[model samples]
Target: MHGYANPARFLRLAKLLTAPLLIGGGLLAVAVLAWALAAAPAERLQGDSVKILFVHVPTAWLAMGGWSAIAIASLSELVWRHPLAGVAARAVALPGAVFAALCLATGSLWGRPAWGTWWVWDGRLTSMLVLLFLYLAYIALADAATRDGQGQSRIPAIFGLVGAVNIPIIHYSVLWWNSLHQPPSITAGKSEMAAPFLIGLMASTLAFSLLFGGVVLARMRAILADTQAEARLRRRAMNAADV
Candidate 1:
């Protein structure tokens, strides 16, 4: 991380990686989603609704994972004063919120047929909703700092750290409270899902995770470009005054 602290170094590497990550992720996502729709069999109970799992599960994972990235970046900014940390946290906020929203939307679509209603105040659902709100707060706080010309503030970082408390709650809510959501279908070393569904879902998850990384890198590069342009304009104004 410190090694790439220099914007030049980071830009060089990001430029090298950005295209591949996005292109490859896009191709893989197309393939897995196609496969899931065509090949993965319908569940006996859920029937064709199982198709939603590929998109829903991946988005759900990313919603939490994005916040995890923000929290880590926030910690870096606060503890190590990593110059890029706040920028990174900011870069991820929008995408993370997007995924969180997707998770909710997909869940509702699945629920309507599965549960006879669009939504319930199930523990998992409630916690995931809270995660979405946290994403909004972080984005607002971080954007406010940038707009204020304050060069970043501790508030966004602090909120990122504090907001992470919701992650575990989202993860464990199904277990902690009786809910419409099933128990963990997949876990470390073991999965209860049939082989084809398991494989397709994992493939979908991997593709989306790559997409998320590509997006973050792209956003970070854009932010750096904007900052550099602002600095150059400031220098030009100063030089004109000296003249």
Candidate 2:
């Protein structure tokens, strides 16, 4: 892991794996989407509206997964001083934010038919909304810190740690309060979701996970290139100053 932290090694590995990662990620996404949207049967109750679960549930899961990644990266940056940690954290922000937005939108769409409302101030929904805000705040803070010659600042890292505290709150929102959203349909303790629905849901989750990794890898490559360019400019400036 530490050896790969060297940018050159990391870039070399990325280049080697890029083709397979993209191909596998693309194929998995397409297969899952097709199966989820077409092959999966409609819910007995929610009918076609239940199909929204394919998108909504997966996005919600990724929203949490992305935050967890950011938190781990932030921790590594603070403790292990991993050079790529900040890059990984920053790379995940926009995609996580986008997924969070999709979760909220799809949830609202699912809610309208199932709950007779387009929006609600229920605990689960509200907490998830806060999660979305946290992602946006993390991105904004990171962006500001990186700009204006404050690139080495710890503020964004601190913000990421603090924002991670909200992840549990979001996860337990349904359990902690009498909310509009139901408990996990498939759980070790109980299972409310039918077998076919569970299959589709799991497939969707796998697809989204692959897609998220692909996006993060692509973003990390871009960040690495930018970092290298900046380093080159700094070296040139130092050499000119010496002359």
Best by lDDT: 1
Which pairs clash in the backbone of model 1? none
Off by over 4 Å in 2: 150-152
> In candidate 2, residue 84 scores what lDDT?
92
RMSD of each: 1.0, 1.8
Residue 64, candidate 2: Cα error in Å is: 0.6
Count steric clashes of candidate 2: 0
lDDT of 2 by residue, 1-243 (tens): 798999889888877776677777678778877886778887778888888988899999899889989999998898898999999899999899999999999999999999999999988898889989999999888887777554554777878888898888888888998988988777677778888888778877887777787788888899889878998999999999999
Candidate lDDT (C-alpha), each:
0.93, 0.86
Could you estimate the TM-score for every candidate? 0.97, 0.93
Q: What is the per-residue lDDT of model 1 for residues 107-170, given as tens digits with 9 covering 90 to 100?
A: 9999999999999998999999999999999989988898887566789999999999999999
Candidate 1's error at 114, in angstroms?
0.9
> Candidate 1 overall Cα lDDT vs. reference?
0.93
Question: Considering only N, C-alpha and C atoms within 3 Å, which residue pairs clash in candidate 2?
Answer: none
Which window of ten consecutive residues has the lowest lDDT sum in model 1? 146-155
Candidate 1, 156: how far from true, in Å?
Answer: 0.6
